[model samples]
Target: MKEKQIKQFEEALAQKLYKLDTEKHARAIGEAAYIDEETFISPDFFLYARCLVVVQGKEFYEYVV
Candidate 1:
């Protein structure tokens, strides 16, 4: 993705992560979510090599490294 788009995605992801209640989603893996320019480290899922797609009324693209 373009630099601007990537930045926007990162910002959105950060916001989501900040608001996320780790206790509700916490698993046996770890605590809190980690994100940089790329890659999202989840407690249960570990490392994801690609972006995460969520389909609601429309399509939401979450870019991960």
Candidate 2:
């Protein structure tokens, strides 16, 4: 890709990344990972989890959301 196209792609990815940082999605991650009342998850874990979900591309993000 050309320099301009690469910049555009980065900008688009940033936008999608911003959109994925939502309370709804975060809650979903926590809910999905829940394995009884003793299960605990850290804030950093959720952040990384959201990043993984976003990198899976639009199709997966939309499906998960």
lDDT (Cα, 0-100) at 40 in candidate 2: 74
TM-score of every candidate relative to the true structure: 0.34, 0.60
Per-residue lDDT over 1-65 for candidate 2, one digit per residue giving the tens place of the 0 to 100 score: 99999999889877776787766676677555534446675767777887898889789988876
The lDDT values for all models are: 0.41, 0.74
| lDDT measured at residue 65 in model 2 versus the true structure, 0 to 100 | 66
lDDT for position 6 in model 1: 100
Model 1 misplaced stretches (Cα beyond 4 Å): 21-65
Query: What global local distance difference test value does model 2 have?
Result: 0.74
In candidate 1, which residue pairs get closer than 3 Å at backbone N, Cα or C atoms, i.e. clash? 39-65
Give the Å error, residue 34, model 2.
Answer: 12
